[model samples]
Target: MKRIIPLLIFCFLLAGSGCANKAQSGAGIGALAGATIGALTFKNKASGAAIGAGIGALMGYIVGNEWDKYDEKQVSQTLEANQSGQTSSWTNPDTGKSYSAVPSPAYMKQGQVCRDVTITEDGGEQILAKACRDEDGVWRLQQ
Candidate 1:
């Protein structure tokens, strides 16, 4: 009965927060899952909740922060590319982290919107930078 109560509460909280697309919802659900799992592992609900919330918050912030920076830079690069007739190429400049932009022709035909870009840094890290075209037909970050 005690275990079932916690499970039910967790479900209720997750569903309630999932109603919106806000990042807080992600953190909320993360905390719930973290707490539940932590409790099962350590048999301490308070410790679990605290640990879970801390983990969730940190993960959320990290993922969110990286995304925000990438999105902004991607947008700026896309528009600058469009204006200069040059494709986007980025590098850490300090770390020799370098990558080139591959624009989607479909989006470019519409307005040079670089929705998905391929990034290859010197560390051999290949990443996808997702971007979108703004109301002015200029590429921009989703934020």
Candidate 2:
């Protein structure tokens, strides 16, 4: 059917998009699911799909952002406990994604304690990340 072709294409695109990041992956998945539901639930399939996709994307972004926060928390904890050059590792219970971080020595930046870290994901790509501890002693990832 005509509808089936587009849906299949969308799914393929979604699969590729998921590789980007959690927020993006969530949006792609949400849009696909929303479009399917909207097409089935509404008389005007096109309009319904559009509206549903928008709503779904927003919701998905929120959920995905939370996941990001959770990951950041883990990274912060690792930085707090491990010594410089010692790798700290953890696996996310929710996503089964594993990460390891090796933090550099703590240094002062603009009066805040900061550390540079190398974080490896699933033993594959490694990303350099930075985190700083505030007065309240919470370690926050620096952009």
Candidate 3:
């Protein structure tokens, strides 16, 4: 219970960051999960949490990186295809995690094309994200 309090506080602090990227979010969530599991499983909570956090961060980074790529691709394709209100889904074969994205209509912002997308994960987590086209014609998440 004491450990959980600190983790909750950490998460609240993390949430206060306005422009958190995927890796940061992943690391924070992963660390929290790792610490909880470690505290419950090991006699030495501190050591377990340290080891678990490291492993969790690594795994989270890899997974989050892949998800970022996948999102970019999906968003780009949706924009190019001009298919607003369409739902596209994909499943990672390695992890068996499924994801879906529904893009809103594309609009112009400061002469740049932008879109809002609602992404849903297999476990029902959802995030609303904004993506914009760069000068190089590549779509990137808006900070």
Candidate 4:
């Protein structure tokens, strides 16, 4: 039964991502399936429901968190791509006007690339932005 619960949850999670429905709904469906299987296999409906709920919540949390993080990384990568060494005078895409940003020591890599930097704008100052060598070897900020 324990083994079955994991396999069931794995299938549900995969199915959920491939599916275009709501996360809570998908998790609820998985939990229902888990509970049904557990009760039938072990003859304990209460325990089965508890176990099903716990496993469902865990899987849902992981999938939700990973999806959010993946989005953030992509946006960060895009910003880093667009602003690498274009010049001291770069306009922030967010504000349209120029902002001052300076690359920290992190930007200086002997061989590897520096990227995903954030800049604060000020009066007439040259702003530094995050920049990276894109996969194509050309440095772009909005990759």
Candidate 5:
């Protein structure tokens, strides 16, 4: 019962925070996953859960903090509203990371609008991505 109380408190805090972005959501997911893994892998379930939660939260924060709604909007607007050669750029106020996206001309694929784009992050890292417009008219990045 005592162990459950701490976990409940943790969950309550996570829920109360509103989890307005990916980082918060990641932390919540990581905490749950870590707790499960820790319980299965260690003799001291509570201690293991605590350690796992810490590690997982850090990892999740790092991964999920990379992008947010602003970044998504920048990419989508650049692809949908501009010409092939046009580029769009934005800087994240919280992280100080700058991003730029350049998109190729849109083409039709299986009744969907598709485009290829190159995104530069922090002025050095670059990623090539493909995106397609869905039935709801939202552009989604392809895996």
Candidate 6:
């Protein structure tokens, strides 16, 4: 029961944090599940939970980061292929999440090509994003 209370509190905190991005959300979820499993499987519950959380968080971050990359790839493609004011849309084959991006006119920023874009997720909120083209002509997303 003592352990359970902390777990519940952790869950509440995780929920309250809003997560913001896939990587953060993944780490929180992984830590929670790892703690639970470690507590059950090991005699030294604290050590077990700590170790499990570290490992789980690493694995989760890798997966979540990959998803972020995939999303970024789509964004980069859209930015490169579509003209300003035209919207490009796609569904992630792995996650089935659909998104659409509408890019504004390109502008020069510090000698590089940059464009502001709006991305909308199906049934979700829209995100205002920016991408810049590098010397190599690759479009990179900016925070």
- Candidate 2 lDDT by residue in tens digits, 1-143: 36544754674486366344677667767777776677678898877776776677677767777787778888898889989999888887778899999999999999999999998999998988889999999998886
Better of 3 and 5 by TM-score: 5
> Which candidate wins on lDDT?
2
Model 3: lDDT equals 0.72
Task: Pick the winner on TM-score between candidates 1 and 2.
Answer: 2
For model 4 the TM-score comes to 0.32
- Of the candidates numbered 2 and 5, which has the greater lDDT value? 2
RMSD of each: 8.2, 4.5, 5.1, 12.0, 9.3, 3.4
lDDT of each: 0.54, 0.78, 0.72, 0.50, 0.76, 0.77
Where in model 1 is the C-alpha error above 4 Å?
A: 1-67, 79-87, 92-97, 106-116, 123-130, 136-143
Using TM-score as the measure, the top candidate is 6
Per-residue lDDT tens digits for candidate 6, residues 1-143, read 46555754574366347434666666667777776677778898777776776676677667777777888888898888889889988887767899899999899999999999999998488888888999999998876
The pairs that clash in candidate 6 are none
Query: Candidate 5: where is the Cα deviation over 4 Å?
Result: 1-47, 54-66
TM-score of model number 5: 0.61
Ranking by lDDT: 2, 6, 5, 3, 1, 4
RMSD of 5: 9.3
Residue-by-residue lDDT tens digits, candidate 5, 97-142:
8999999988898999999999898889688889999999999878
TM-score of every model?
A: 0.40, 0.72, 0.59, 0.32, 0.61, 0.80
lDDT computed for candidate 4? 0.50
**Candidate 4 lDDT score at position 31:** 62
For model 4, the superposed segments whose C-alpha errors exceed 4 Å read: 1-29, 76-143
